[model samples]
Target: MTIASCGSVSATTLGLPNSTAIPAEKARLPKGLFVAKIPVSAKTKQRLANDIESITMLSLLQARNTKLAAGTRVPEILVIGLRLHEPNAAVPTDIVELIAMQRKSGMLFVCVRDADFEGTTRQECAFAVRRALPARAGHTTTSKVFASDWQPAGEATLNATDPAVDSMDALWESLCSQVILDDPSPIDVNTRLARRMQIAQLTAQVDKLTRDHQRAKNPEQRNEIYAKLHKMKRQLEELQGQ
Candidate 1:
């Protein structure tokens, strides 16, 4: 197993010589960090969501120094789970756009195979990474892509029914030791905090709208509440998408 040195810490010292180990305290992904799921199909989406949930649950259960959750806010990492039927499957433009947005926010992007599907080729994986994470003109040399074919340990494989959970655990190990690119310029701390505040405010508004819609007794009043609720929901989605 190859281990990359991150900052002043060696991967071996971080307990990541192989992808099966829990990351050291300093090497763990941020607590309460959001991991966005991007899967093209409904089936794949559900699987990916389950995978993320399971990964978080296992990490917490084992007392790992990481706390992750699926969120709509600007994510720290974007997992693109695709099931390719043909060797030449085209990646959708909207997906590319979403990736671009995440990249601009200095988030890491990873492409994985969907549950119960054949894995994508290294070439395909590399292509997705490159497209999603284009290097700046003078910083081309800094752009590096890491690829690994990971298999879960026998215990994890036997205990977990969903393959995605194991895949996520392996991915977490990769992330801990810089197998994936670390954000060079993380989103400003103040900006992120402020955005969270805004989201909270919007969410409260949504809750109020829901209550109003539920209490309306007349059809005309219900129609008015419904329109307002729809607008608020759309705005919330747009903010979360960002």
Candidate 2:
């Protein structure tokens, strides 16, 4: 059930050299799952290789495909477009097997660089997880596995480049079913006071920009600041969602 784009580009940029499909280890379901679109960079893959195990192997393409069929998926799937990257990235097979044997929770969104280690750990982990689930290929009226999306934003421990979110809107929409767009809800009362303060500031900025656009002296001025205002609005929206 593994899917690659029909287009000619690399999966790293949204296309794959091969349209090969691989099946899962078994058709059984796992206790936990983390379906996410994480951007893994080459540097990040190399650094985290030791932290991972065989359970991260990309042998569960079938289960992953089934997850997609069941209306579940991380926002995006990438391979960093590298041919030499090995599945599991040197993760110990025993550790991988241990993960395979355990029951997991919800899917986690992973963040990775531009398809650098995507083929290595991203796919490997995905395959291992789906493979661990002993489910056979068939439509499920119900499933416990859930999906999430992630983009690396420079976590200090990962030592990787932060992902730029500008071009991932379509991907995000796909992952979270944003096609049925609705007016955002009111602010979450549970949010931290500091975070609420930032949201307030961003709100004020959006209002000011709206005013400036209304009184803009020229089209260029309006357009330039309008983009900035839109950016601020999006950032606020992202934070709110978080």
Candidate 3:
């Protein structure tokens, strides 16, 4: 995959509008018969492959257990190898074609890499991927791809001295949580309306809190009101950002 320079492009350039309303449809990890593709060079291929396999197995097992407990169908996940050229170079046509083919087959594609070809941080690379994702609509898009970095946290340290290592279990847990939350289901009109109603209710609560805060005379009471106001604002942001 081509790793674009961070801050090199704006959302507008990617055809994303600056709107407060979240997209009605979201790109999600498939619940059944999905695919994860990990591409690495031959030098680090075996180690990276092992790590990806372990992570996928752990996540799928956990997801299956949760689904079974909820009386939902247990999902089937498959991990496959995907070879890519050097990171800084354009993505190979074959890899792009493969992604298109997989999406057509109703399979989700996740790209697992340790870092961008230019050595960008994992978090930044994820952000770039997110930015590249097309805006969600009522219909499915041709590309349903996600990416992640698997490097150990200890590689980057504060003060360039004492490093903190994150366990593989922790990374897997985090990735699985993201997959579950980002489920690609489209929200129906009714659901959208319902969400809007909830947002309205929360807005009313915020207004009431603001009024109360203004009336609060004692320092302690004012502090409490401010705290409530802060929490309400955060909830509003989350709902608006959807």
Candidate 4:
């Protein structure tokens, strides 16, 4: 029954407290559960099985048990650790999404892999934070996963220095910023994530338009594609500026 101090989960162990390791099997979902609940393709299921070595519940963060205040949006946070089978590969997002969708609390995944560096073995870890948006009028709730770049397990640390972390939700936002890197302007995590998604979509659209412009045989078709591409690029620039 040890409580972690504010921002106590270091990058090496990924929120895992020394005294509170849950049974490894408890972290694993039952077979067929993903297939039954989530629309998982056979390929994704196999990929998750092949990439993940083990899953375990490392720690649970709550206001009652920890120093962080209770949040209206997020009452608790679950710290789940995933060990990868392959040192270079990551597990599919399908499994992470499925788990996040089922849980009420915020989900944070810490994935680790062991790789050889200059004839010496070293461990690397990556962090993923889940943001769950409540269901709107006539729409179902959805969750988005934001992941971080892999870091050497021995050195990286979570950034919890923001003074705004007065509640669990704010703390979650701070962690999300660590993984995704917040925008330059002052905006909440949800708004920043939405803008990011929009940027990705616009970038993909511009790429497709560029390819179409290259393939167009008629001058008129090329001109049309150029205009669309220009507009998309402008939109992208605007979003990025914000």
For each candidate in the order shown, give its overall lDDT on alpha carbons: 0.37, 0.33, 0.35, 0.67
lDDT of 3 by residue, 144-188 (tens): 233433322223111101112122222222233233233222223
Decoy 3 TM-score against native: 0.25
CA lDDT, candidate 4, residue 201: 90
lDDT of 2 at 22: 18
Candidate 4 lDDT over residue span 74-112, tens digit each: 897777766777766663466677667777777777777
lDDT score, residue 147, model 3? Answer: 40
Local error of candidate 1 at residue 216 (angstroms): 0.7
Better of 1 and 2 by lDDT: 1
Enumerate residue pairs that collide in model 3: 28-184
User: What are the root-mean-square deviations of the candidates from the true structure over C-alphas?
Assistant: 18.8, 18.4, 18.2, 5.0
Which wins on lDDT, candidate 2 or candidate 4? 4
Q: Write the per-residue lDDT of candidate 1 for residues 47-78, one digit (tens) a residue.
A: 33442221111111111222323323323333
Q: Top TM-score: which candidate number? A: 4
What would you estimate as the lDDT of candidate 2? 0.33
TM-score of 4: 0.74
State the lDDT of candidate 2 residue by residue for 95-135, as single tens digits.
Answer: 33333233332121221222235454233211111121223
Off by over 4 Å in 3: 1-75, 88-143, 149-242
Q: State the lDDT at 138 in candidate 2.
A: 88
